[model samples]
Target: MHRTDNRHAPGASHNPRASQTHSGGSDTGHQSPGHQGAGHQARSVEAHRESVRELLADLAGTGRTEQLPLREALGRGLAADITAPVDLPPFANSQMDGFAVRSTDIPDGGTDLRVVAPIPAGAVAAPLQPGTAAPIMTGAMIPPGADAVVPIEKAVPDSFPRPGSTASVRLPATENGMYVRTAGSDVRAGEPALAGGTNLGPGQLGLLAALGITQVTVHRNLKVLLATTGDEVVEPGSPLEPGKIYDANGTLLEAAMRQAGLEVLRAAISTDNPEELTAMLRKHAPAVDLIVTTGGVSKGAYEVVRQAAGGQDIEFLHVAMQPGGPQGIGKFDGVPFVGFPGNPVSCLVSFEMFLRPVLSALFGAPAPRPAIRARLAEPVESPAGKHQVRRGTVLPDGTVRLEGGPGSHLVHALANSNALIHLPAGTSALAAGAEVEVWTL
Candidate 1:
């Protein structure tokens, strides 16, 4: 049964009260022509963002965790705090390959000490005889009674003598504990090594391995059913029919979702037929935690997603944002559904603006993209009543230049850009050198 929670449904009405916090005027400058609707009012970006957050809120409380091997745990969020079971380094070890000797044995002017048996890494060395030194390799356990290590380069001979040969090497004066990695110095036993909600990365996994931890407990990844629609969409590598374009949205969205640490189950391409699309969603809905479909939420004559999801609690609406103005969010057959526009760039921007942030806040897996302020390298005009997200390249001098014009189909421009230039809804135009907010891609 399809259900709609009032809290998660933002399409209750076409409220045209755009937030005045952002600069505004009539939607004239950079709005997509295909997305402009004369009668329907658009919602603010913040309202739709909040709706998305509300829809996905329950994911964080699922409390579902899984035990995975260290290798498999990469990109997963830690379910619980991981405390160090043993002191890092485990014991006092040599930080240099040289002689381990009592600091008192070396005089202020320097002195020569008889070398005892050599100690290599992984070997337990006998305590150093009072006035003698021990040749120790890096990482070798420091001999008992020895309080300092002199690097081999500091030795007069500058090298270790043959094992068992009586050799006395001149050593310089040194302080206690010099060149020694003391137990617990890196991390003490019982100290928190990793906190809950930490996204496991290469460094985190390496640390766990160094601590002799072979497995970790982490939050299970959210599984999503991804579908892309459009009758003109065809698979790549196949011969392109005259009026058909390759299905870039499917690949683009799948990559974005995966990079965000989502487990995507991409469905076969759905045609423009409403019934076929609905059937596909119904088939995959049971297995995934969320369903995301691209290319059919607009109010066009043949909007399949709108037609199919009309009675299933999905609310199709326009957001006061350029490029990705159209959006649909609600439940389909008891599963969360998000409908994104079909244009490649619009689809991607929608994901970044709406889905990515919510996922980060809820799952703690893909950390949020960094938002920064950069100077504009050139003047740019934006729609009077809509937030404009333009592709831009940040210059070495910290200024950003537009990669392409404000078009939803500008995929190539998006590829060459490093940031998303954000001009708030009320903003109409800005001169070069104006400081603007940007999101690093």
Candidate 2:
């Protein structure tokens, strides 16, 4: 029997789940100064999943592909249905190197057939005449009147020789439909080969290629505009003043967005200013499908993104989630805008929990994995009314152990963890070996 362990080992080992998190989401939603933690309803996992599903529904469906190059089609969603033009296989073909024979010709001493034409794959073939054998290579078309194929290893070469080669087999047991692929065996004409919302992975692409499709209609890649803002933040390579730290969220999130197959980090600016952030968004929002901004979304007076969208439909919902609770979501200049807390870890977690789920539904990729039930290998404390997504590892023996301290803003810990074990709202603590749910990173 196989078991998964979630316990912390003495040293680092490969996590059993081998999972990647959704985009930037702090597993934790934080509290600003002078604010109180509101009592939060701990919704069931299914309820949270439904919330993500609804958000995707709110967005207008992505644009239809006018046309797309097959080379760039990986991970893109198909915009329209694709049907096969002709029957797959197109004709009867042998599945093995064998001799084609009438079903009645089988059984020792049943019928001694004379040799006729030979057929190889990629060569046109004629139907076999009664009592005559056609030498057939693997994938060679079976001639008419032949109902079965006898493996070459079982047939006598003297019985039916290759057209231009000495290779032959001894005639043996003949089985019906043995090593034969009939016309349209895999797919029929007029049947849907691919459909809208299908993401083109290797398997799907192969299926399309099998149907002879050189072009595909796929949804336009989601275009997103992003900005990082903070007076105390400096871009890398620039000298930093007192109390100012270099911006990491911008580059981190740009890489993350690129990883998710979105168009990001293309704009000219990577600096911080309320006016600049607002202008960048206002200018790009119309052209892009979504806008994301980090840093200035916090409650501080200098919160550029929040102030810019002050009168907009944006709502800063301090979701009960930890490390990523400070979030704003709504429309801006007719485009959907998402705001993430400034902290690097928070932004990462926000992307994982909220943005990625919605994106998965829209773009049709596999959704970020959800919390799986596991047993804790040690005891831990939690803040009441908050759902903490703490970094952890799941062992093959089924124990889950914390990877680092519970601080949600630690980027290194976030990177090392393979999962976020859920500490449900209002739960103060848990002892070792308690069953818990963990969200795979």
Top lDDT model: 1
Model 1 C-alpha lDDT per residue in residues 351-404, reported as the tens digit of each score: 999999887766668878899999999999986667889999988999999998
Question: How does each model score on lDDT?
Answer: 0.81, 0.66
Worst 10 residues of 1 by lDDT: 17-26
Model 1, stretches more than 4 Å misplaced? 1-47, 61-63, 231-246, 271-273, 300-302, 370-376, 384-386, 394-400, 424-441
Candidate 2 RMSD computed on C-alpha atoms after optimal superposition onto the true structure: 8.3
Q: Candidate 1 at 225: error in angstroms?
A: 1.9
Residue pairs clashing in model 1 are: 23-426, 24-426
For each candidate, give its TM-score against the true structure.
0.82, 0.78
